[model samples]
Target: HVHGHFFALLSGYIDKFQLSEEWHRFTGDSSITDVRKCYGEPRAALHEVCKYACKFSDLDDPKLWEFHQGVNGGRMFDPAGNLRGVLTGELDQDSLEGLSGPYRDWVATWLWLEKKYHLQAGPPPTMLPYV
Candidate 1:
């Protein structure tokens, strides 16, 4: 019974376990050589994955914003305090219930397609201060 709360919690795990610098310790590789290597394919870097995911605007709805907020909070914004992505919003408890399943499924589908097609580089989207 995955819900918005669960998805929010899972995002933290994804960032900490898959996207952090300590990922090398888990993968036993200093540099990520393969996108398939990490759990949820998160080793590719958030900006890269964000660009890849942004192609499908349908996936960028409020659920995505909530998920990122749960994981990284305001850290996604630029130093100038500009929020990333044109579509941004706050998620409420009511909306979370409806979006939970669809959000998870969409992410899974995106990762599978990304692996199958080997999507390449593009101009980084305007998200996160570091990006």
Candidate 2:
């Protein structure tokens, strides 16, 4: 699922703008409950994606922190995509561990690009990637 989502984002078949729109259309607000209401119960991995989106949107609020804490600190995601253990992939790992690994690194890289390009990967619509 993570592979498919990553490739969907990477291949230009579905851009962040489209995702942002879909997020807005589904969520109707920034609340995860709303996300659940519209998209059903999202996995822990999906929550990380939302956190990244919130960061991109400059959503420096307590709810975001709470959400982070709630979803992280568990090995739900697969760290190596190996099938040996529970392979939840990039979406289910704890926050600190993930920060030390590839997901957070990728987020940092995207943050750099966003800063350089003055773009955002989340809500408010206008700041999202155009292409």
Candidate 3:
């Protein structure tokens, strides 16, 4: 079953923005919980979904550090889904090699920037790439 509370929250925003038509097209036959469409173009809906989760700058340093400690060393997201074992390094090299390209490039770039700047990949990393 869909999470009614979350859907209601998004539905409120959809109604407020008068995006019923676009929302219908975006959801199609999928459950309300499905957010795969938000990753694509027309990111207004994605912004709605992420706004709450992304608001950390408003927090003061102590509160922010407390929040960090609460979630540190925990897996915050499961991007691998069914391929969790492979992503967690439990699988052989061939399986992992298939997933390398873009991810490898991104990490290499991030590492180079971090080392060059003597910085860590904090919530707001010091380096940002131009699109």
Top lDDT model: 2
> In candidate 2, which residue ranges exceed 4 Å CA deviation?
1-3, 6-60, 79-82, 85-131
lDDT of 1 at 79: 27
34, model 1: CA deviation in Å?
Answer: 18
The lDDT, on a scale of 0 to 1, for candidate 1 is 0.36
Query: Which residue segments of model 3 deviate by more than 4 Å?
Result: 1-30, 33-53, 79-83, 86-131
Q: lDDT tens digits, residues 1-131, model 2?
A: 22222211221233356556655554454312222122444333444454453453453556656766887886655533334465345754544321121111223223532432222333222223432
| Clashing pairs counted in every model | 1, 5, 0
Question: Quick one: how many clashes does candidate 3 have?
Answer: 0
Clashing pairs in 2: 45-91, 77-89, 77-92, 78-88, 78-89
Q: TM-score for each prediction?
A: 0.16, 0.24, 0.28
Instruction: Write down the RMSD of all candidates, one decimal each.
Output: 17.9, 15.3, 13.4
* Per-residue C-alpha lDDT of model 1 across residues 7-113, encoded as one tens digit per residue: 12132223343433444543344533222223454434433444543443344547666765676744533422232354546542233211221122113234533
Candidate ranking (lDDT, best to worst):
2, 3, 1
lDDT of 3 by residue, 1-131 (tens): 11121211121123333343444444443333333334334334434443444355356668868988998999866544344564444332344111211111111111222222122222332333322
Candidate 1 to truth, TM: 0.16
- Model 3: lowest-lDDT 10 consecutive positions: 100-109
